[model samples]
Target: MELPVRCFVKAVRRCFLSYICLAVFCGCLMGIALIQMIDGSFKMDIFERKQNVTKPRTTTLETPVHISPLRMKELAAKRANKTDLKQKWLNERIERLNKAAQKVQMRREVTARPVEPSDKFHIFYYAWYENVQYDGNWQHWNHEYLKNWRKLDTKVYPTGKHEPPDDIGSNFYPSLGCYSSRDPITIDIHMKQIRDAGVGVLIVSWYPPGLSDGAGRSSDLIFSDLLNAANRHKLKVAPHIEPYNGRNPVNFLTHLKYFVRSYGNHPALYKVKKNGKESTVYYIYDSYRTPASSWKELLSPKGNISIRGSAQDGVFLGLLVDVHHKHEIKRAHFDGFYTYFASNGFSYGSTWKNWKTLSVYAHKNGLLFSPSIGPGYIDTRVRPWNSGNTRHRRRGKYYDVGWRTAISAGADFFSITSFNEWHEGTQIEPAIPKSTNGYTYMDYEPEGPNFYLNLTNWWVNEVLNKTVHF
Candidate 1:
């Protein structure tokens, strides 16, 4: 066996080699198995490098913005100055108004007239509401009757086709005046119409007096018109100052001059008798409110030009005293005064009895006196009436009675309440009493003469000419 073992030494080496190879193979297989067991992933790699960092930079705290004290003070001073300026403006305005008021009061005291029945008393009406002016545009005109009336002739009024209606004779409204548009054409036309119609004198309305306010501002506008009208038509213009306003004296005087200078020589300018000097007619609405100061200023010796213009020779100034304020007669400052009443008011019933007494007083004072009459009152449109105060028939029974009473009192100049005041149910035209038609706010119907016109005609024959026909 020993000999055999020594002989197989090489063989044994060979066998050992074979064994090592087998072991190597087994290790390789194990490595492959481990790789398969675990999950594998492929990734894209990227690399970026930045600059080196330096020491942190230091920063300083910021100071807040501030406003200077001087600027604040400057703003406050500006505001105060503005306030002072406004106050000064208001003070100046008030002072001017006061001075104007004082001037008017003074005039009323000196130039007032007393009533004289023996003198010629004229009846007039304010017919402004019928002013349908034509300013190139027909849309501004409101009088349709004017167009029809104008077709009659140019002798009365040559005003354009769109001119106002000459409705004063039948449908007059008290809201109109000749000076409205500052255009002399209207004045000329108005005067011509009055002259052609045989209207002796026009009793126009005036304001800025005690009974009226700034309504008198437009008075001057018509001053130039009055001059033109008077010169052309010999139509007199009598401005009736309303005693309701108690306006500024300075303003009134200013108007006074404008009226006199512009129409001084006009043939239509009012004349007191025949050879009087002045060419103006001043009619006060009431005697009571004629401010004493205004009277003194008008007739004072200071020689104010305005007073002289108004008081020059031909002037015939008069006053109208409403029954409501008749008590002021004792203190009235005027050249001539007249008595008028509102029979529509319940109080008028009692006041009617006082007409005789007032007439006697006016006659004794050497003053010119006139009276007014009308149908019962019921101004339903302007002021509504209750059941007991319904509108009266146009020619109601009371209308004739009222006329008789006025005539009996020797009322030479009688002013009918109105020509066409439909609101008062006193319109005689359209035959209020017998006609089926009630009222036409402004329309004119041939069938009726309107209550005012009826009364006017009556006065023309009975009072004005002392003759009555129908």
Candidate 2:
């Protein structure tokens, strides 16, 4: 009887040892799975799906060992603490590995990529702002609250002009509080910002010397100052013809000659070679309002008022607002077309989702398609009823997607909708946090103020480095 009892005890000991070995083997497998899973790649998700099957462990509670309830709880807590510690350590390890990979990539890019601005990048620039310090009073910053025509109750939208220096027209306040565009110091700072972002040209809003837009003075007065500042930074400047009084193709051609005669020799005046001729580039806003025949008369090489082969000839980019403008631009004999509206899908040409189709069509027709990108759009403060058009900036994610999608859609050249069109809240210029007059302004939270600029520089380098293939 004694020998039998001893044999049973030996058998139990052997069985217990076998279970421990099996559990250790399973734990090793789990550790390997965790390592692969925590790498944070697409493969991790796929691996997780394949290994989702659960194999129950007959340990602890299922074991025949006897223990008080309190003792069991303490053991379970200890086990949980151990798991949490392991997870924390694992995450730290993964983070270190990822940082190391980024360091290697940065080294490679430093050797391969040039940080200088590329001519392919164009930024829409506005110079309509004014302030008391520079101009004796605020201009666009005191923008009036626009009426919402659709709403019968006018009270639905706020009325009156915005008070400057504290309350501005924009939803996001600028870092430069109530700054005047004519300020040389401010202009220099702007040029440096543009250059830092690797932007090559500033497509400035322009009207004739005396002509001006509503709510602000004529931008023409500031052109010389802009040109000087831009030249200092080795940046080019192009005139963006705004829709103003008495603007037609013939008169616009005359204005082109005027610009040539006036600022033609300015070092900052941007010129591009096209159709085997050297000419400055110009953007015609609201071009759809003009008849195609009228433009053809001015742009066609053999037309009655053709500027072709002349000194004032320019590579003109017409604003594309609707789908039919695609054919009109070609018919009008314009050099190219650009989608200007920052609000994506607000116009047929500005829709990001339609860019692939648009690019394909442009390629087939042999026209250059420059898809305009905006960081975000929000004019709700000025146009209170235009909430549908407001595109929230998801802490810089919005701008990132715009860059990625544009490049992925085979866009070789693209334009930013604005550098400082603050009225539309599309400005990539730095913005700061503010709460004034009981209004809390939005900011680029989870990111620094210069995040957009840094991001633009990064994307520009990524493309120019030949690392990210279009």
Candidate 3:
């Protein structure tokens, strides 16, 4: 045991070499055991090489493997927390995007130029004109010639003579003849005439898409052209909603949305100050067809489809055909009232004497009162049975009387009965002295062709100059 230092060192080296070899042998055994456990190939090869090999004995261990349920729950909770955070981030992002879009829209509305003034005169304009060649056939011009038209006709017709443009169904004949609304020249002429007359707004007769009055064709296609012309002449346009086939509050709300989305940005679309907010104006003709309850569903502040204080909000002016309509309009939450009939004594509201009372009622209820006036009314050629309702022109005195009455009544605005409703003989558009096929057309007479236009300009100036505190 007490040998030399070199011999002891050599023995230590040999012992280390033997330990290394033993470690290598154990590692090789572990690798082989792992391979045998992972793959059944070793046992299969053994069985194939020695078909007489016996099965090995197996032994069981007493120790049992354990897992921590608490640790598993902690891992699941961490994963759920990650998912919730992701979802929360996504929701916040969406909310932020929506808010940004709202801001942009608001900014656009704020930045838009104010083209329409708070106080201005408006006129009811008809755009339901068509040409026989372009429109495929004679339309409203031959309304009296259709089947059952004779039965419904209140006027006497000649045996077999039906003249168009000059001696058509309407009592009044247009100087420009029967022209299409889509005609650029006609639109230009209309815009110039309206502008020259100092009318700030034109409430165009409008129906839902694909719908039109029984006698005329649809004017929806010409709206854009009309707007373009109006813009060029610095005139604003409001929609006069006519009765459609199936119009309800819910559907009307959709129509309003469509109008706003389509033309709200246009400079020519008429907008006015309403309840401290600038909004578009819509004149609803024959709105009583839908009940006040239904209208309240959209017009009232607490309505389900209310546009109050929203960007798409508007001032809806209901037709006031009678005195009782004021109460109905108030109940329906309309913004204003307008008399559409040209005949002065036709209705309570249309009569010149009742305007002051109606205006007083409107003021009490904080509603706008706009009285409609016309030059004259004579539809004998169209409704001979109703000739009693006709009011003679009296050489422009009738129109002057209406203007004076409207001015005295303290109207918030003034509306002309029509610019081109020739059927009712209410059109202030120029009429020519025409004689065709034994039918003689009436003319302005004594005055030039621009008589009514000049009269309108004078009244418009008066309206603009006069100031009322209320």
Candidate 4:
């Protein structure tokens, strides 16, 4: 049992090392077991430190629960109330709409579906400038003409009412309550279309003729054919006069005297007489340029002419009402305003409603409201926006707003901006086919027969019979 001291020490060291290694192995196994107990599974000792070494258990965050719908309804009921005036207003409007719908239904029952293009609808053509002068002939290009017009002698509609498109007539065709000069043949063609469409009148775009050397003159040739055609067609002719363009009181009275004397007896001539006298409607295009005082003076004795022939004058001034510059509308003293529409610009969408509200105020003040409808908007190109979208949707929902707004405004009449303003691509004229946003030629889907025919008829029906409110 006895050994050298060095050997005894070495043996003791070996025993100590063995005992330490056994204790370390047992400790690792226990740690792994503990980790498995917590995790509900077993893993190698290498992963035991990662699992069993957790500092603490986490507490889950509580989620808030919503109240029941029954409680919400009770709360809402306690606060809910509607004003009598608002309720009455809504009811009256609904009643009006219902009556309008019923009337439309009745009309459909009575009048056969418009099978003829001419019979379908009527639109003011000259305002859009789709009619151009070519070789002493005024050539018209419109959306309807472009999409459906055939080069044949007679343009036929589904209803088979074939009327040769005149394309030639007088130079001065009445339009949009005014008169403008074009080739005689062009005017004739335009008039024929109006007649075919069953349009009741042509609001001639008129201005006194200016001299070759910037001097004032008695009249323009534009009025010559308008009066003649209007007389012949038994269509009402209303001449819009402007006194500011050297149309002073004397000249105005002279022109009025001439117009009334020459065409007064014609069946188509408009004579709005009240209190035993012929009334004149001087639709001033630029009311601000020519003040109300000018109008007053023109109708007065000092400006020239005798008051003897002067009778009841119901002057209706037309101007584009800018809501931002509403002061212009208020200051102009217009009997009514002719508001314009651009489907794309700032005036599109919700702004249309604001214009409608303004229209209501104008109507309440005895002003006749006339608003414009165009193919689309191009004002952004003319007056570029500093920021945001410079372009707009031309064909889709954009164009619909103007059409719907015009109806909703209970518009006195709808003035389609152009039958042919092709540069902006809003022409309803044939021979010109181009599509720009909001100003596309035909923005309809099935693009051939049904769209154009139905559209024309719809516009015609709305203008002739329907009533709308915003």
Which of the numbered candidates is closest to the native, going by highest TM-score? 2
Q: Predictions ranked by TM-score, top down? A: 2, 3, 4, 1
TM-score of decoy 3:
0.70
- Which window of 10 residues has the lowest lDDT sum in candidate 1? 43-52
After superposing candidate 4, which stretches have Cα over 4 Å from the reference? 1-185, 196-198, 211-219, 231-234, 241-258, 261-264, 271-280, 299-314, 323-333, 341-351, 377-399, 421-426, 434-454, 463-470
Clashes of each: 56, 0, 0, 32
**192-271: candidate 4 lDDT, tens digit per residue:** 55554445555554554452112122234556666676556555665555444465555666666666666556565555
Query: lDDT values of the candidates?
Result: 0.45, 0.84, 0.80, 0.47
**Candidate 2 on 12-125: residue-level lDDT in tens?**
999999999999999999999988777767777777776654533345756455568999999999999999999999999999999967964553244222479877899999
What is the lDDT ranking, best to worst?
A: 2, 3, 4, 1
Which portions of model 3 show Cα errors greater than 4 Å? Answer: 1-119, 145-163, 467-470
Expressed as tens digits, the lDDT of each residue in 51-82 for candidate 3 is 53564333335534354899879989999999
